[model samples]
Structure formats: C-alpha cells, structure tokens
Target: MKTYDILILGGGAAGFFTAINVAEANPRLKIAILERGKDVLTKVRISGGGRCNVTHACFDPDELVKFYPRGEKELRGPFHTFASGDTIEWFERHGVELKIEEDGRMFPVSDSSQTIIECFLEATKKCKIDVLTTQSVQSVYQGENHWKVDTNQEQFSCQKLVFATGSNPKMWELLQGLGHSIVEPVPSLFTFNIKDNRIKNLPGVSALASVNVNGTKFESAGPLLITHWGMSGPAILKLSAWGARILAQKNYQFGITVNWLHTSDAEEAEQILRDIKQNQPKKAVVSKSPFDFPNRLWESLVTASGIPSEQKWADLSKTQLQKLSTELTQSKFNVNGKSTFKEEFVTAGGIDLKEVNFKTMESKVLPNVYFSGEILNIDAITGGFNFQNAWTGAFILARSIS
Candidate 1:
C-alpha cells in the first residue's frame, strides 16, 4: 500500500486549499489529494456563473459570520483568524487579483473561474502535492497511529487525514462508521416555485421587498426577483438558507407573504395610496406606478386588486383602495415547490458541528482527522459567503496540520 504524511479527500475548494496551504507550511511533508471524479474543482469552475465568487468584501469577522445561517456561532473565532481580507491578500500573493462588485461579491479581475482553477493547479504542481483523480474513496478507518483510506484505485494511509468532500453521502456514512454523527442533508439556497397571476409573465422583474414564510418567524428583506418559476434573489435566498430545515420538514409546501413596498404595515401603505388618489385623481391607476419598482409589477398588483385597467384614481372606492394597499404591502402566495439556484446547490446538513473543533478544524471524536467546508453542518446564503467559509476552515485546518 502507498502512504503519505497527509491525505485530503475531495479536491474541491476546501480540499485544494487545505492541501496547498499544508504543503506551503511544511514543504518537506508528502501530501496528496484523492478526488472521486475525473475533474477537480468542478464547483469552483461553475460558481458565480463561471466568474468564481472568490469571497465577499465583508472584512469584519463579526459581520462576516452573519452570512452563514448554520455555522454563525462556531465560525466567529475562525473568521477573525482568516477572514475575507486575509483571503484577498493570499490570492494577491499567488498572482490572482480579485475585484469586488457593487453587491460586495469579490471575483477575479479576469472574471473567469479558469484563472482560479489554473492557479490552484499550478500551486499543486509547484508544491509537489499529488492530485490523484478518479480515486473514489471506498472506506476509511483509523489504524494504530495512522489513518487508512481504501479507494477504488488503491489503498493509502496518512498521519493526518482531511475530509473536504462537500455533502457526499457515502463519505458521511463512512464517517458515521467511525463514530461521527451525520446531520441528514437537506437542500439549502433554493428558489420558491409558485404559479401565481401576479408573477406570471413577469420573469426577471425584480424589486426591493420584504418576504416572510407565513406562520413562521423566517423573514428577509432585500431585492426579490420575480423569476419564471417564482421568486428569488437575496431576499428569498436568505429566507431559504435560514429556514432550510423548517421548510424541509414542511415538505417544501408552504405559504409566504411578500411585502411589495418593502414594509409590513398595510396601514402605512394605505395612507400612501390615499395620498396618491388625492394627488392624481384624473390619472388612470394603471397608467403609471407611484412606487419606484417596475411598473409592470405595479400593473399586475393593481389588476389583482380588482381594479379595472382603465379605472382612474378618482373613481377608486374605499374597498378597492384597501385591497390595493394590502396587495402592495402584504401579498400572499402559496409555494408548491422549489428550484435549485442556478447551477449552484448547497446543503444544510453534514457531520454535526459539535464533533469538530473550530479553532483547529480537527475532528474532536478522532485524533489527526480533520474536516472543512460543507462536510460539516455549516452553510451560508448566496453571494461569495460559502467560498469564504471554505477558505477560512481550510486555512485553519492547514495550520493545525502543519
């Protein structure tokens, strides 16, 4: 059987980061990455629509931890150790310049994920770290003072073993065999599917709004995009991440309230509507939208409020005004299902967080065993936050190993 000082499973972001950092810290130690698929860094190549959201612009560790719905408390200390600023400096030193977008998402100046992938590949080659692909892990266990991992190709052992395989069920099962608790994976960062007239033919229509999963405390406020399937964007994605478990328990069938005006108070919206009626009495209610959002959306809401297309603001009755106010401030929709956000898929479960040490990113249940990335019960909403989590954990784990 072949052997190495370090063996990292999963050649994705976390795995690659850990391997490269470990090799850099301990140049004399032998290291290898075992990848199941023929291609490594597939997720990195496709993230951010091929742009590769390297990290978010948030530099504060306290604020950065807020993005992660699951790993918030546990990651507080780790982020302080290696946050977004550290990530930027690391990439800069590696000859990859990162630029921050208006939305606070940082991407390579090249705007191509290939740049990031190529950088990783070059680093591995330079560090003499073996990146063995198509080596699916069969089983892994501790033996004497080393960790033994059997794969489809061959058997390998290492003094330090790391599992960065994000959301792999087979790996979770293997970990469970070794006395680790799996959190039962569930879908996170998904868009709601709703077939509603208010949103029909309104694909791509986006606005700043507040959304709440009806009958629950899960609520978010941000830019909500009306998609062909239903609603998406930061507002909905935040709610989806924060409520992943609860929504899964409900079987993805639930009700939600959309505050079109970005506020929950219907009375406040009603007062604004009354003022509009008094100021623009002769103007057709559907002719122009009084709000800052898209007029097409306003027209749809007006029609849904039982107002005639040609009806002027002067002819609006009290009930019609009230209905319009409610529709504007608190429109309700029944979500029947969900759709994955673009090509990105994240999960809300993995090895339980309690089983790992955040400071060292080492397994508390087993010595010399480490985990990083989604293998732990940690995930964040969209926007480069997930990648940041991977970097932070991998860096900390690499330090511990070295």
Candidate 2:
C-alpha cells in the first residue's frame, strides 16, 4: 500500500489546482492525484473549442456569485477569498497570460488549452506532486486517523482527501457510501431541441431576444441563435441552467414564449409596426425588416403571421397587423427535447450544499474529506463561471487542508 500526505481524486482542473496550491503552501507535504481515465485534463482540451476558458473577467465577488444558480449564497464568502482576479494572477504568475474576449470569457494568450495543461503539469512536477492516471477509485472511507482510498490498480491512504471528479455518478455513489447525501443529478446548460417552421432553414440567424419557459417564472434575455435543431445561445442557455431540474421534471417537453424584440412590449411593437406601415406603405413587408433582425428571420416571422410573400405594408388589415405584432413580440415554440451545448455537459446536482462547508470546501459530514468543482451542487451558466467555481473551491480547500 502507498501513502501520501494528501490524495486528490480526479486529475481535472480542480484536482490539479488543489494539489498544486497545497503543495506550494506546504512544500514538505507529499501529494498525489488519482485519475480514472488514461488521459488527464480532457475537458480542458475541448473547453472553449480548445482555447480553455480559464475564467470570466468579472472581478466583483458578489457579481461573480450571481452567475451561479445553485451556490450563489454559499459562494459569496469563498469568492471573496479566491475569485476571478486571483485566478488571473495565478495564471499570469505561472507564465500563462490570459486575454479577455468582448463577451468576458478569458482564454490563454496562446489560444490553446495545451498551455493551461502544460502549466498545471509543470507546477505539479515542480511541487513533486504525483499525477496517477488509470487509477479509477473503487472506494473511499475514513480509516481511523487517515482516509483510505482503494483504486482499481492499488490502495492508498492520506491524511487529507479531495474528490474533484466532476459530475461522476460512480463517485457520487462512493461518496454516498461515506454517509454523504447526493442530490439527484440533472442535465444543465443545454439547448432546446425544437422543430418548427418559423426557424427552419434559418440556422445561422441570430438576434437579441428574451425567452421564457411556459408555466414557469423562468426567463432570460440575451443573444439567441437559431440552430438547425432549435434555439440556443445565452438566452436559451441561461433558462436551461436556471431551470435544469424543473425542465427535467417536465421530461424536456414544454412550450416557450420568445420576444424577438427583446425589451419591446406588445404595445410598443404594435406602435412601431403602425409607424412602419404609414412610412413604408409602398414597400414589401418582408423585404425591409424594420428591426435589427435578419431578413430571412423577418420573412419567416411574417410568413408565420399569415402574411404572403409579396404583401405590402399598405395592404395590411387590422387582424394582420395584430398577428404581425404578436409574432414579433411573443412568438411561441414547443420544446420536445434538449441538445447538449457543444462539449459543455454541465449538471445541476451533486453533493448537497448543506453537507459542505463553503468556508473550506470540506465535507461537513466527513472530516478531512473535501469536495470541489461540479462534484458539489454548484453549477453556473457558460462563460467561464463554472471554472471559476472550481478555482475558488479548490483554492479554499488547499488553504484549509495545507
């Protein structure tokens, strides 16, 4: 049997960060990370299309916590300890400078996730931390004075243990065996799989809009993109993240009301339509889209409103105008299923928040056993918020454990 001062399960971002920080804080303490798969940092390789979204540019801790739907209140204290600014400084100190995009997602200046991976590997090597792969953990329990972990290949014990495995059911089960309650996991950050003619053949079209799930108070407003399958982007993704459990309970079958004009109300939309009718009376209704929407999308919405291909603004009756206004302000679509957004398969459930002490990220139910990343009930919308949670939690765990 092997032994170490600290043992961290999973070799992903949270695992590596915690190990490195703990080793840095206490240079003489031995640390090792056990990874289930042969490859480590696989998620980092595909995140942000291989660019690796390190974190967001949001510096305020309170503002940062707002992005998280689950751990908002719990993370308020931790983010004050080690938030996005700390993450940026840490990466910069490690020689990996990050650049922020217009949308606030930060990526390495190298524009390659390999840079982040190499940084972690280098830090681990410098700290003399072992990263063991293909060591799938079979079980974990407190053995008197130490934490005992049995992997498929070997057995080990450590004074302190950390579970950084993100959204792994087997790990959750093993943790449950350790007397921790696991929240039922549900899919989050997915796009609605909608099949409708209003958006058919207009896959590349995008617009700033507001979307709300029917029969629920869930709502979001941002840039919405029309995909071949349905609608996606920040607007739809925010709704998905915030309503992960509710939508799953609905079995991914529901209806959504979309406001293409974003902040425009029904009355405002109708007034704008009437003004356009009076000014552009001779022009084709579908040819000149009055709003900032794509021409194809406008034509489709016009068609859905029962308007003909060559309908002029002057020929529109009262009913046709009302229909057009409704289509522009409150379009409805049926969502039959969901599609995973790119490679970001985030879940909204894990170890219950009450079972974790956010101050140290240590399990309240198990001493010396810590949790971080998606292993906890904390998840956030896209744009590097999830990774920020990982960094914050892992950093706090390192401080407490070391």
Candidate 3:
C-alpha cells in the first residue's frame, strides 16, 4: 500500500489548493491528489464562460458571508482567515493577475481559465505534490492513527485525509458510511424556466429590475436578462440561491414577481406609466412603450396583457389601464423548471457545517479528517463568491493540517 502524510481525494480547486499549501508548509510531508475525472479542474475550465471567476472583490468578512446561502454563519470564521483579498494576493503571487469588474466579480487579466489552471499546476509541481488522474476513491476508513483510502487502483494509507471530492453523491456516501452527517444535497444557482413570450423572443434584452419571489421571503435587485426560456442574470441568480430550499420544496414550481421599473413601489411605477400614457395618448402603443423596454418585449407584454395596441390611452378603460400597469410593474410568471447557466452549476447542501470546524474545516466528530469546498453545505450566489469559499476552506484546512 502506498502511504503519504496527507491524501486528498479530489483534484479540483480544493484538492489542489490543499496539497499546495500543505506541501509548501511542510516540505518533508508527502501529499497526493487522487482525481476520478480524466481532466483535472474540469469545472474550473468551464466556469464563468471559461474566464474562471476567481473571487468576489468583497473584502469585509461580514458582508462577504451574506452571499453564501448555506454556510453564511459558519463561514464567518473561515472568511476572516482567507477572504477575497487573500485570493487576489494568492493569484497575483502565482503570476496570474486578476482584475475586478464593476459588479465586483474578479477574473484573470488573461481572460482565460487556462491561466488559473496553469497556475495551480505550477504551484502543485513546485510543492512536489503528486497528482494521480483517473483514480476514483471508493471509500475511506480510519485505522488507529491513520486513514486507509480504497480506490479501484489500490489502497493507500495517510496520517490525514481530506474529502475535497466536491458535491458528488458517492463521495457523500463514502463519508456517511464513516459516520458523518450529510445535509441532503440540492441544486443551486440555476436559471428559472418560464414559458412566457414576454421574455422569450427578446432573448438577450436586459433590464434593471427587482425580483420578489412569492411576494415575500426572498428579494433581489439588479440587472435582469430575458432568455429564450425565461429570465436570468444577477437578479435571477441571486433569487435562485436565496430561495433554493423553498423552490426545491415546491419542486421548482413557483411564481416570480418582477418589478420591471425597479421603482420604490408598485404605486410609483403605476404613476410613471400613467404619466407616460397621458403624455403619449396619441402615440401608437405598439410603436412606443411606456418604459425603455425593448420594442419586441413591449409588443409581447402588450399582447400578453390583452390590451389593444391601436386603442388610444384616452380611449382605454380604467380596467385596461390597471391591467397594463400590472403587466408592466408587477409581471408574474409561472416557473415550471430550472436550467443551468453556462457551465456553472452549484449544489446547495452537503456535510452539515455544524459538524465541521469552520476555523480549520476539520471534522469535529472525526479526527484528522478535513472537508472543504462545495463538499460542505456551503454555496453562494453566481458572482465569484462560490469559488472564494473553496479557496477560504482549503486555506483553513491546509494551514491546520500542516
């Protein structure tokens, strides 16, 4: 049996980072990364449309924790240890310069995920970390003072084992067999599938809007995009993360209320529409929408609201005007399902955070066993926050284990 000081059971961001940190911290300590997938960092290669959103620019630990829907309270301690600033510095030190966008999302200046992957590979190589591809670990066991890892290839022993296998069900089962409590996993960061023409044909059109899920409980305001299937972008993604559990409870079936104008209230938005109608009563409703919405979207919204485009605002009844106001300001759509955005899909639940020490991501129930990344019940919104959790968790565990 091959033996090492530490055995990491995944070669993604968390596994690689843990190996690099441990190796760098203790040169004599042997470390190996076992990855089941053919290619390492497959998700990283495809995340953020291949740009690899490294981290968010949010530096404050309190403010940063809010982005994570699952591990917000538990991640407070970990974020303080290694926040987004630490991530930026880590990448910068490794020869990959990252730039933050106006929306606070940080990406490599090279604008290629290869840059991040190459940097991780280079770091692993420099630290003398052994990476074995196509090695899928079937189970892990604790023996006296060491861990025995079983894989298809062979069995290995280690002083410590880190389960960085991400959100895979098999990985969770392996841990659960060893007496770890796992929070039921569910999909997060998905776009809503609304089969409505108001947003369908106007695919790429975006508007600054506020989305209120089921009138209350969850709300997010930002740039919203019209997709071929439904609505998306920052606002929708945020709503999805915050309401992930609720949506799952309802089987992804719910109604979404969109405040198109993003005004203070629906009454204010209605007043704005009323003023537009009064000023442009003679203008063709099809030709001129009350708001700055796209022409195609305006026509669709008008048609969906059952309002006649040819009818002058002066000739329209109070009921028709109220209906148009409802369609524009408080548009409600039936969300039948969910669709993944780009190549970025995240799971919301994993090993419960309470069972793991956030300071080091080490299991409180099991000694010398650590957890990190999405494998834990920690996930954030679409912006680089999720990746930041991986970095933060890995850093904490690596430091503790070393």
Candidate 4:
C-alpha cells in the first residue's frame, strides 16, 4: 500500500488547513486530505449566510477562548499558539483579504465565500497537498508505528492520522473503535420557535434586549429579532450557544424571559413606563410607546399587555401601567421547540477535550493520531468563533506534526 506522512479525514476548513500548513512546513512530507463530500468546504460555502465568517477579530487569546462554550478550557493552550490574529495573517499571506464588521465578525473583503474556498484550493495546490474527494473512511486501525485507513474507495497507510470530520457520527464511531473517548453530541446555535402574537406580525422587528434563560445560568444582551417563526439574532444565538446543554437536557422546551426595554430590572423598567405614561399621558398608548420600539411591535406588545390601542396613557391606572411594564420588560415566552439559525447550525459535543493534548491536538491515549475542528467537543458562540477554533486547532497540529 502507498504510504503518506499525514492523512487527514474531512476536507473542511481544519483538514485543508492542516494539509496546507504541514506541506508548507515540511516540503518532503506527503500529506493527503480525504473528503467524503463531493465538494470540499461545503459548510464554509454556506456559513454566515454565504458571507463565510472566517474568524472573530478578537486578538487576545484568553478573550478568544471565552467564546467557545464547550472547549474553553482545552482551547486555552491552542489559542496561545494560533488565534484570530494568526488566522488573519494566514489568509492575508495567501492573498485573501479580510475585513472586520462593526460586530467584530471578520469576513473576506470580497464578501464572497468563493474567495476563502479558492484561497484554500490555491494554497493546497501550491503546497502540493493531495486532496481526495468522495472518499468516505470506513474505519481506522493502528499498524506498527503507522495507521491503516480504510475507505469506500481503497485503503491507505499513513504515519500520522488526523480526524477533522466535523461533527459527523460515523467519524466519532471510527475514532471510538480506535479507543478514543467521545462526548455525546448535541445541537447548538439554534433559534427558539415560539408561537405568540406578541411577535407574530412583526417579523423583522428587532430590539437591543436582555435575554435571561429561566432567570438563571445564562444571560445575554444584544439585538433580539422577532421573526415569523419566533426570535433570533445575537441575543438569541448567544442564548443558544451558552445554554446548549441545558436546553438539550430540557428537550428544547423551556421558558425564556426577555427584557425588551433592556432596563436594569422589572421595577426599573416599570418606573420608566410609569414616567412615560405620566409625561405622555395625553397620547394614545399604541401611537406613542415609551421606548423606541417599532410601530407594529409596539402595537403587538400593547395588545398582548391586555390594553386597547385607543386607551390614553393619561387614563392608565397603577395596575395597568405595571402590567404594561411587566409585558415590556420581563415578557416570558414558552419555547416549545427550536429551528436552525439558517444553515450554520453547530453542535456542542464530540471527542472529549480531556483525552486530547491541546498543545498538538493529538490523542493522549493513542500516539500518531490527532483531532481538530468540530470533530472535537469544542463549539463556540456565533460571530466566527467556531471557524477560529478550526483554524487554531489545525494550525497547532500541523506545526507539531511537521
């Protein structure tokens, strides 16, 4: 059988990066990436609504690690080696320019995922890294000081094996057969699907709000969007990322409290509403909301608060004002289910981080084997953090292997 110095499974960001870096670092090393999918970087093409959020702009390694909800502890060491700054430099060195958005998300200057994909393809070609597509690895076995990889097409031998197959179950199963510990996988970064009139007609309405998941454990404040299905945006996505495990345990069924006004608390928000009612007492409640919420959203909130649109704030009693304040500030919604945050849904569990050496992403239990990317139990919040993990882990492993 033909032998290679490095064999990487999965042609996603991590695998391609590992192949390119290893080939560049060691010119004589024979590196091949085997991808089951017909097209490489399929997810990359669809990530970030097709803009491909390559990485976050956060430069501090410690700060960057906090974005990952799962592998924060394990990724601390890897981030020190290769973080967002490294990602920027690597892409720029290869001729792909990236720009950071106001929200700290970094995307290609071309605003096209094709830019990132072509850069990887060109880098791989320049480095002479072999890429095999439509090759599904069935299993992996250790051979004396080497690894025998069995695929649907054929079997190959490699001195080093790297699993970057993303969150695929079969990949984890293959690794488990090779005696690696894997954490049970679960969905992360999803939006809540709630059926409520409070946000029904106002599909595109969004507000800077604070979301408290059951008033404990997880909390985030950002742009909260009201979609036809339910709620989304930075606040909702952050909630999904942070409470991925807890929500999964609760079977995606839970109560979510939203502070639409983003005031300190219910009492504080109630005082603000009371002041508005007193100040704008002559105005119709629907025509003039206390906060700068959208007209449709304000009407919806008023309707949900059991107040008529024609009711004058001047005629509002203390109890009515308190009710409106409660509805505006601490509105509780039942999240009966979840829907994908577009096509960029990520999972939060994979190969347990404790079993892998973060310095090199190599398996501590098995020599000559490494793990990187989403294949491990590392998942981050939205805003390019997940892609950063892939780049960081792959870069570390490539350096160590080379």
Local distance difference test, each candidate: 0.95, 0.94, 0.86, 0.88
Candidate 2: regions farther than 4 A off: none
lDDT of 2: 0.94
- Work out the TM-score per prediction: 0.99, 0.99, 0.96, 0.97
RMSD of each: 0.8, 0.7, 1.6, 1.2
- Best of the two (1, 4) by lDDT: 1
User: Per-residue error at 220 for model 2, in Å?
Assistant: 0.2
Per-residue alpha-carbon lDDT of candidate 2 for residues 1-402, written as tens digits (9 for 90 to 100): 999999999999999999999999999999999999999999998999999999999999989999998999999999999999999999999999999999999999999999999999999999999999999898887889999999999999999989999999999998888799999999999999999988989998999999999999999999999999999999999999999999999999999999999999888998999999999899999896889888888999999999998989999998999999999989999999999999989999999999998888989999988997999999999999999999999999999989
* Residue pairs that clash (backbone atoms under 3 angstroms), model 4: none
Q: What's the count of clashing pairs in each model shown? A: 0, 0, 0, 0
What lDDT tens digits, residue by residue, belong to model 1 across residues 1-402? 989999999999999999999999999999999999999999999999999999999999999999999999999999989999999999999999999999999999999999999999999999999999999999898899999999999999999999999999999999999999999999999999999988998999999999999999999999999998999999999999999999999999999999988964889988988999999899999998889899999999999999999999999999999999999988999999999999999999999999899989999999999998989999999999999999999999999889
Tell me the deviation in Å of residue 130 in model 2: 0.7
Q: Is candidate 1 or candidate 3 better by lDDT?
A: 1
What candidate 1 gets wrong by more than 4 Å, as runs, is none
Q: What is the lDDT of residue 349 in candidate 4?
A: 87
Model with the higher TM-score, candidate 1 or 4: 1
